[model samples]
Target: MERGRDTILLEGLRILDLTYGPSGGYAGRLFAESGAHVTKVVTGDQEISTFKDSRKRMIRTTDNQLPETIAEQLAVGHWDIVLWDSHMALHLESQLASLLEKISGSCLSVRIHFPSTVDVKEEHALQEWGGWTSLTGDPHRSPLYIGGFPATSLVGAHTAAATMFAWLEQKKGFVQVDALTVVVSALEGVYTNYLETGEVRERVGNRHHTLTPMSIFPCQNGFSFIGAPVDEQWELLERWMGRAPNPNWASVDERQQSYPALEHCIADWTQGMEREELFHTGQAFRLPFGDVQTLEDVKRCPHLNMRHFWKGQHPSDGIQLPWIIYRHSSCKLENRSHSLKRLRILDLTSMWSGPYCTRLFADHGAEVIKVEAPHRPDGIRGNSGESPAPFFNELNRNKCGITLDLRQEEERAKFLKLVATSDILIDNFSPRVMENFGLTREVLWAQQPGLIIMSLSAFGQTGPYRDYVGYGPTLESMSGLASLTGYRDGIPWLPGFSISDIGAGIHGTFALLAALYFQRRFGNGLAVDLSQYEAAIQLIGDYIIEETFSPTPLQPVGCTSIAELAIQDQRPLEVKTSDGKRSISTPWIIDNPENQTYEPAPTLGQHNPLLEDYMAKREWHHQL
Candidate 1:
């Protein structure tokens, strides 16, 4: 047997696990394979069916009545990690306090539960803590629930990572966290963009502001992506287009202005080839080329298997699954001699939130393939031009893409074939859409029972609004983001960007990774129902907590023009909560006076022959 190098990190720590279901089970599994020992503690008939070895397991008394005693006993022992996932029962707070008090040394304590503490003062602080839902949804619509079961579960995962970091650094003290602030912290790059300008970013579909030649294009077969970062690639693109490098269109800016000419050139070249051929040829040219793969195309990516990206295996259905799992170069997977190694993910989810979550996996080392349909492509795709626009490409990079007409029977079958092979399947489409396409949980499980399905929708599958047709704007309105946003005096303003959807996407990715981690340990499957509205609510949970605990509601600031002007010449406005906690937000306004309304995208398909068949055969033979 090819024993893949044991890469799982955190190898020796032991977790006194009290979590149940996929969420907590996942967290425990992650700790376990990362070189930790996760001994699940359960009472009554509820065993760790998620894993099969429960027969040789540690069991507490059947008395759910003595969980406090169980926790206290576990705390006193030499356990390095403590993971708890129980509902907020009436006496849960007292029980937890007793358990914390009994711990002899400073080990990590991970608590995953809803609010029910006696002390109300901490609630306001928690709400204002961060990942504040205020940033979610569209300006017009009520803030929607985040897609997938994001908010709380993501908070739990964040807590785990933070606690792990604290434990690793040997730091002790109360470390309060929530989903909102964690999301913001993950936006280091996005925040840098904001800091450079003086304006907050609004949604702009999938179009990127900084890069050119990064957009999805419709091909004879379907859709494909081309991302060219510089000029030489643009020239090489011209070679592909059967045209000599245009001297006039030498610069990125020049090529952007002559977008029509560039598009015409590319259109002629791409119009001649098959989708797969276009993708391979583009990749050979070293251009960031990806197919807007549908669920089907994603399933068949050989790169994923070669790279060992999908791990959670389902025997009955025999499908490889995707998870929110990634690895950094520093955390060598081959060095650790582990089952599943430490992986870093940076999810940037929105509409169905799949892309955002996959971004996390992609950023690390997971071979994430983002699926988009051309006809009813991601809503974010069509928000710009008649063509499938650059918006989709920006949100989806470092990953492969392919288009599928899920509406068609052949396409639907192709999609199923792909699902049978994917490690993770994240979709924010409504439950009805999946059902219409024959992609229900039962259907998916039947295909590959161990598949980790990260379903992102406007509302949950079982909720009253389960069938509601809501987008970022509608979800924003529903989630109360609209009411919370805008000027202090005028009507509440919706943000130009779909923060809620995007936020939900990021959080959903976190949740999916957690699930993947768990499924790996148990050899089972998990279905994460992520509601975008709920995810939004989770992001702003601290704010909601503030409203519940504080004397006044969170004050919404509409126009920051006054604040902007005040900081125009001075330092940027930094906000301090009433309790003296400080935070900052920046906008994306350009400082250069010569800024134009639209900066053009760089042309990658400049040279006609380089991207054409004549060059195609040469490139083909060269690879062989």
Candidate 2:
């Protein structure tokens, strides 16, 4: 049977969704959206978001009936995936073992856990415990909650991806996805910075920790984010502002030193123009500038509308729904211990998004080769002279690293040769960077026609803002996340970390898994164009839906009061890197029979000799 682009990737997969809360609901929703037959067993009157229940078939039942419902469903052996939360697991504790036994070999069970002390209903407490509230908002004021139930949504993404990974490996035992771990994992450089420098990361309002000129500024009508981290962007900004570049503000460190003064000058210049005008003019200079948009403004965004990013309104409330747009040419029922052992991935991504995506695969036995340029490696590495930052080491662990200056013809040839032997190629460069390097999708396909190519761009390819540069903050502002995440009286605020980057990375991981499945099943190649902008908007889908039907606009509440409670476990799980540095372990916990081990991130070009040996052998194989 031939599958068209419109065909759902997980079409025939059956999922038994016994989850309550946003986390499990969202996970089940992802499965449902991918065309799985997801039967959600709603046990209580607990409110459910329309976004989470979009494509699922609901089965209303009472707490008493829940056990029987799940038991019956598992007994039939019809479900490929089973999703539930810790609360429900406790509810059916006596029968939980038996119910799980029924699907032990046939189905994959995923449990989303939170601390026993914290109630799932208390969003603020979860945020605080998860280390999110501590890092958001202004340093002096109360820490703010990231708008929408982002922590739960992040857990949902993890749950869905874990289930898919288990399914791909054909391992059907038990998987536990901790909500707090998911939140902590997305903290990016926070923990590492504290570990390395003993300096706890505090709120800096809309400013980034490392990047200068990457903060929000007030315009004539409203505020806009300006992210120009590179020296080239700084030069362009100066030219646009009609000022000669000063030698003092040349490098990143110098600009950081002069942030206050530079910010003042930029603010003065921006104050003369309206928000829209400033956005367009800044974008004209190829700067990553975006107007802080409200939910209403996001609804009317031309790029989102053109892409049909929003599904139809809610059935009962007429509220708009956000949709995940997959470009196509794209899970599972299997359990091999090392499912991806033979697979090789070429990771040409830097910073968080791309590295984070490939890291997931690297942890699960996939051979991932992280490719960076000799001159300019991943930005997260900080200065070339210093050791790779803790965050970089944490994200790039278990992967081999090699340097390739693609600008040089020799390096480009080496990269192409690598692509020929690799199964997947991942990059998060701007849409033009790849094309300019003469490594377009067409060119890559010629090297390995069955290659699964995924390009994670700021705004997607072919969109009006495709060429526009953006970081996490830029996307957050442009996608309406910043607008929804601050105090009512305060201006828009960015999240504690580059959340959009992390979210897009998880989405990319899931998409790549699906693409790999499709390739193995049908022998076809796929090109995935993932837009961080759209992924950011999807994170606030619940808010978008709620505001659509509400009489008044949604307003941000600074922070909710948290109660002191005893958590089940007070100790944080830390793993030792190859360099003896302790970092957080992988987020989720799996209870499979196979044991997995961790490895530290490789040093720059650490595996160049090994890669060269492999490439020589691959070339020899090709000649034969």
Candidate 3:
């Protein structure tokens, strides 16, 4: 696994990409970017877009030559990974079965499938079938689909991740990733709420289900999200509005009851101010605010520009991608039967982005320590009196939870002790929080120089908006996603859930794995600054590129109609939690014999004793 300094993370890996659409194409692009030698075999006259095809070698073939071409390629050399779409499977099922048998023990093959309900390869119709369309846009209007092929893009990401997992584990198998399951998995709290309470959530325009003032408000020039979901943030908003904190608007429930009046009051205050002014002012008050940015605005975004996020040959094409800033160093890693069995992660993340990122690793046998302060546990755990939320259990499954008030010196010392033996540290706090905690890269590296630190923030760790706070909706609004979502003539609307959070999590997991691969091969430590905003923009990068090149702007269609078909009602695979509550299983379906069984999420501080033992040993020897 040794490589030269000039080699990229996945340089030695060879991938044969036989994907027909953007779903598999995006996955190949990610592999290519990480330095894998990706060869895309095009069986038709499909136009190759620079965004998805730039780093890959292209081979053309007719439909009739597909099987022969694949056999020829497979014979020439061993490919570490092979990717194809389900549509291609219809024609080459027997051919693939024979070919795969020859390479079954050596290569990881991934097939991307649309739901059976989708008779055509239409993304909009797939969205409708997956329930994404039904949950987006205004409740009074027709359901809207998210801009770009987000569902498919997510499928690609998940497919890439699954492939990497198998590769790391040195397993030979076939993996199936479907668009419908990926979409349903990302619905986040929506399905969980329905299952737990039997409450079918409908479109609430731009507002959050429980969080008040988390909606887009019109500014003098454009719209901006004034999200103050937390009580502290809401109080700041009240002070900024030159009003005393009224008792009626004290709690989330109270604010929900007074939604109309509160929204009207905020809208009135914001209507006269420009979006930029409102954004900065609200951020200065420590409120989570964001500008509803268009593609043009996103192109000129100072934070993205400063981070050099818009890369590739044509930087002006507005092709935004993830940027991983690395520092040179070295460490030794032991190979394990399970991909991440030897890996230890300290997850200091709350809500969705960071938790979801670590959860992926946890599911694959990583020792993930979900660290939270006693006073401020992960917000998704729900209020003090209630049981942990279903979304929390789903996202944090198979992870060890321990409360450590980092603010206290004793707890901070224990955490640093754990860091000395850990491989990675991930946090989604505002950029300043790490600095405030005096846990800078230099400080953490002093304990373990080869530690891979990943920070998933709203606007990243640098740039002007580095300190600004934001949630998934804020990032979505700012990432140009919201502007392209909604009816053609209607205002921009957010997706049913915090899609940006989930998207960032998936992207973060991939990026972290890439870094992990590098660490294992070269023993080098890296710092990955993942912005949920940039990650959101990347999901719709093709659309942005299209809009940049096209004469007319891309308009949102509420929902596209398709011929009626017998949509399959295949229930998603589920596993029972420790409480006997059923939850959707992890989206990947890999035919690997060594896959671990599902485990229930840990209760708060459930693994405190485990942490105590690790601290006593000053090493991670005992498995949870």
TM-score of each model, paired residue for residue: 0.44, 0.90, 0.92
lDDT of 1: 0.45
Ranking by lDDT: 3, 2, 1
User: How far off is residue 65 in model 2, in Å?
Assistant: 2.3
Residue 330 lDDT (model 3) = 52
- Candidate 3 residue pairs that clash: none
Instruction: Sort by TM-score, best first.
Output: 3, 2, 1
Give the worst 10-residue stretch by lDDT in candidate 1.
596-605
Better candidate number, 2 or 3, judged by lDDT: 3
Q: Write the per-residue lDDT of candidate 3 for residues 1-624, one digit (tens) a residue.
A: 122212287788999998777778889888887789999998666768677788899999998888889899988868988888766656586788689888888888888777655543446656776677666777776677787667767878888887887778777878787666676777766665556666666667777767898898888898998899788888888987888788999999999989989999999999989999988988888888989998879877888777777664345454645755666445454442235777889999988888888988887788898888888788888865137888888888778888998877898899899998888999998888888888998889889878889989888887888899898889889988888886666467787788888899998888887777766776666788777888888777876676544321232343321111112355454556556775666677764424456566777787788888877776554445
Per-residue lDDT tens digits for candidate 1, residues 328-428, read: 21211112112211232212133335665564344333444444555544544434423333333334434444455667887576556556545567776
The candidate that achieves the highest TM-score relative to the unseen native structure: 3
- Candidate 1 vs candidate 2: the lDDT winner is 2
lDDT of model 3 at residue 365?
81
